[model samples]
Target: MDPQDGYDWQPQQTGYVPPQHRPRAQVPRVDAGRLWAGGAMTALVAALTAVVGLLLIRGVLGIPVFAPEGDGAMGDASTGVLAMGAAFAALVATALLHLLMLATPQPGTFFVWIVTLATAVMVLLPFTTSAPLDARIGSAALYLVIGIAIGSLLSAAGRSATRQDF
Candidate 1:
């Protein structure tokens, strides 16, 4: 017989042997009570995000869903539909974010700041296309700020909620 075969594979001493592969314990479930308010907030935020996304899609696509009474520099069926869609999406996102926040705790001030920025962008999207060349730049800036604001706030809330130990 080979020398290796005669020897035992297991360790000779076993006072305190650690497992080579330890399974991770399951995370504790968050209580429904704890999540109620945050869940609502998260839902709102998600709705807002969706709304903004829809508006952007409509604006670029020029979907003629609605027919304005008369043509105007500011108003058009396609434009209106697009803008409305955007606003709605944002609201939806707002709901989503609200729900997310309900689960997690985070910095409220910073969160709101982001929401304001994204909302501002969506709010001024109509102005974005109709403005003079110089004004267009400003509109773009506004949209950027608003988008960032919304994104930041939503992410912050979500992070906080998810991070909860419970």
Candidate 2:
């Protein structure tokens, strides 16, 4: 009834009450199937790089790259080596890209560019060397084999990583 009572109001005091079980956020689940597909995709990219390398030499450069026409400018052995080496370098680059590109977890622009440049050099290197172009190309193939080995190692590592549950 007093006028002063209307003017004065009191605030309530409360304690924080946390739930017995706090709700947790869900993480986006990654399927194992995608991992296999990713690996295959990477390998295909590498192989295609090798094939394109051969074609570029024949197409863009107008060079008899893979096909052994005559004793090439670099001679047979040297040219073959260069070709194989370039392919190998591409394979290595692909694996490295896949492993190192943690953000993407796949091949990206950097890997492709590096491999492309190396492949081009391998394609063209024999011409400058004393050896024949075929030899250089064959040498390049050898390097490709080495790269394949490196990729195999990386694939195994990827497989192991995927088997782990997040």
Candidate 3:
């Protein structure tokens, strides 16, 4: 070794291969059973979000939940109805995402755009309703929570549901 050279180099064997250059094994995609299970979990999440958000809006925020069509006065919002709506919304989102995954090449991106647009509509719904300002804001906040939960969970679940063959 010459003084100018920092270190000595050893020659590799004729057939030697570098570890980093080796191909990696592919991971198996999630099966349908797992996907459905995830969807069920998403529904549960939506339900819980609805319940908690509604409670916060009505109980903590002191904003009275009311029926939009009926007398525009402070009224009770059925916890059961809220929970059911959230769960149903999540289920529908999941189904739509699944269909998009099966049919489209870029399902995840498309799903995000779709959910975002839907959330925008939900946010705008309060302005159109005749409910009082506080109630409208509260309901819109609830919609935001539900929309976020549905969008994020359904997107992940849909990606998981995608077939490996694709």
lDDT of 3 by residue, 1-166 (tens): 3244543433363453344434565543546676777888989999989878866766666777644333222234576787888888887887777677667767789889998999889888987978798888888888888899988887777766765542
Alpha carbon deviation, residue 143, candidate 3 (Å): 0.3
What would the per-residue lDDT of candidate 2 be over residues 1-166, giving only the tens digit for each residue?
2254433322333332233323554433333455445554555555555555554554445466545545443335644554454445544554565455544544345544555565456546555766565547654653454355435543553544343232
TM-score of each: 0.34, 0.33, 0.72
Can you tell me which runs of candidate 1 are displaced by over 4 Å? 1-22, 25-87, 94-130, 163-166
Ranked candidates (lDDT, high to low):
3, 2, 1
- Alpha carbon deviation, residue 156, candidate 1 (Å): 0.4
How many residue pairs collide in each prediction?
56, 36, 0
User: What's the lDDT for residue 124 in model 3?
Assistant: 87
**Per-residue alpha-carbon lDDT of model 1 for 7-100, expressed as tens digits?**
3343456443234423455453434433434445544544454445434433443332122324333335544453444445455555655554
In candidate 2, residue 46 scores what lDDT?
50
State the C-alpha lDDT per candidate.
Answer: 0.46, 0.48, 0.74
User: Candidate 1: lDDT over CA atoms?
Assistant: 0.46
- Cα RMSD for candidate 1? 11.9
Residue ranges of candidate 3 with Cα displaced over 4 Å: 1-30, 67-77, 163-166
Cα lDDT for residue 11, model 3?
36
